[model samples]
Target: MTGRTPAPSDRTSRRRRAGVVVPHQPTRLQRLLARLVFLLIRAVALTLRRSLVDRTGCHDPLPPRAIYAVWHNRLALCLEAYRTYARPRSAARGLAALVSASRDGGFLAAVLECYGVRPVRGSSSRRGPQALLELTTWAERGYDLAITPDGPRGPRYVVQDGVISLAQVTGLPIVPASYRLSRFLRLRSWDGFIVPLPFARWEVILGKPLHVPRQVSETEREEFRRELQRRLLEITQD
Candidate 1:
């Protein structure tokens, strides 16, 4: 049951494809606010002491490409985490993150731009299929992919199937990553989003990569999903 890669035409005509809503473009005001937020977060992140524990072995020199599966709650410092640990070792030009295709997503997309990372809009809902195709295009162009297995909305730390599907189609390994902050606050969001305080110690843990075979059955995909969930939970600490 090998998943077929979407055809080149699928990549070329993705936006025009039926059922794909055009992603919301951020207005000028939103872009300005995003820059202010980015600067504020950058100042805080720079004050934190950070370290990486790479169980993946790929960190001696990161793989040319692999999907990073970070939990939704741990996203506050994810972009910085990439800049700290993955980017230096990554042979790829840059990273691309899957974001929601809503008005809120527009603001976040602008923030990603400030970090020089590409934002691929769409989620498990909204323009899902189109987003997947667009992500595949990014992968083909040599950008590493990042996804929150449970995100936009969540059942907390549960792993969703979309990451598995992306790996199947793109033939990239999935690397489960999590971080522990010595000081932090949990927001009242569905995922209990973590906001790390400045000047705290941060430990980013990268688990061994999980390779999803192109010919996986649905049952096997579920098994991979659970394995990812377990690894993420295992390495995470409050």
Candidate 2:
């Protein structure tokens, strides 16, 4: 044999091993279900003033091209709130989210797509590098990027470095955001997933935008992460 390496028999297999395969396309039924869910969320959010809080910045009038950082536990309610508040602000600019690379994230991606939210599937602990790269590209393309600072098998409410890294790389301000519900069911899951009961009073809070230097020190990174965690907790705390 020559010194050159032999090519893989299947491109698909090679791609899978390299973690570069295309995501699965949802079926028609799946798409329909996703659409139904999206519509229901929008309807519910629109109907209840108490069920949603939308505290945005003056930056809303200007196109939204920043990074939105939220906690994992408040995901469900936050999704609806974003659709109501942030959607209109960023509709023209486009919005993309960093989802987990796990199978569960596949379903989540489909759901997001139904709401016109593009999913850049990856997580801080899984496929993180690729996800960060994708997010940077999306941000450079003027898409508002959203990330759950504590997500995808979280330590529950703790912020990871990925979000900070993303902001630094994309040169986008990190907007700390969260939601609080007067009545909701909290899942026993790792992140204590929260689901707001219909008609429940909700408060969506947005902290001032935070910026990270592209060449921050490790200490600075950790400090920023801690600040983000504290801000999310302050908004979501009962």
Candidate 3:
């Protein structure tokens, strides 16, 4: 028996499946709460005594563009770290970070906007393809990207394949960065979220960039993922 070619409708359906979906929009209440949270974050960030530990020159003076991989637990200081460290030295003018597409993510996206950071909403569970496409768009515009490999819910410090795929697709180096807080509270959350105490010493550590080849085998991608996980573990504090 001979095989039949797919119909035009079948091809159209496939194209639709590959297309990006619209991101979740924040509700009015979520927006309002986000503003309050942004104010609180701003107040807390200003009182911290911040420092940087960049042995790898990759972040001291950021490259034209790169992907930053930080642990999920250390996200509390991500914006502060960027504003204090990367933004000043980066040749890139904007930062676009991956975020979830849930209701909570809506609030977070708003807070990110408050910091002038663009949020690409999606995650492994929802709108994943759409988010990756959006991130690629931002990258083409010369914006630096950030992703918490184990974020939006996580297995703590474990790195996921999303970051690896992103690095491969964007052809950007993954710079592992983490934080050490002299004084802070650990929230009873999935990621043990950190809340820094007033006037505490906050350190941002950036590791060497791991470049992912544009063409890589599944085994190679896994290797890169493990390498990123190891580097993040090295820099992250419990």
- Which candidate's lDDT is highest? 1
Question: TM-scores across all candidates?
Answer: 0.90, 0.84, 0.89
Per-residue lDDT, model 1, residue 83, is 88
Q: After superposition, how far is residue 224 of candidate 3 from its true place, in Å?
A: 0.4
List residue ranges in candidate 2 displaced over 4 A.
1-12, 19-32, 51-64, 89-92
Model 1, range 149-203, lDDT digits (tens) per residue?
A: 9988989899988999999999988989999999999999999999989999999
Task: Name the lDDT of candidate 1.
Answer: 0.89
**Number of backbone-clashing residue pairs for each candidate, in the order shown:** 0, 1, 0
**Could you tell me which residue pairs clash in candidate 3?**
none
- Model 1: per-residue Cα lDDT at residue 27: 87
Q: Which of the two, 1 or 3, has more TM-score?
A: 1
Residue 18, model 2: lDDT of 84
Q: What is the C-alpha RMSD of each candidate to the true structure, in Å?
A: 7.8, 4.2, 6.8
lDDT of each: 0.89, 0.76, 0.85
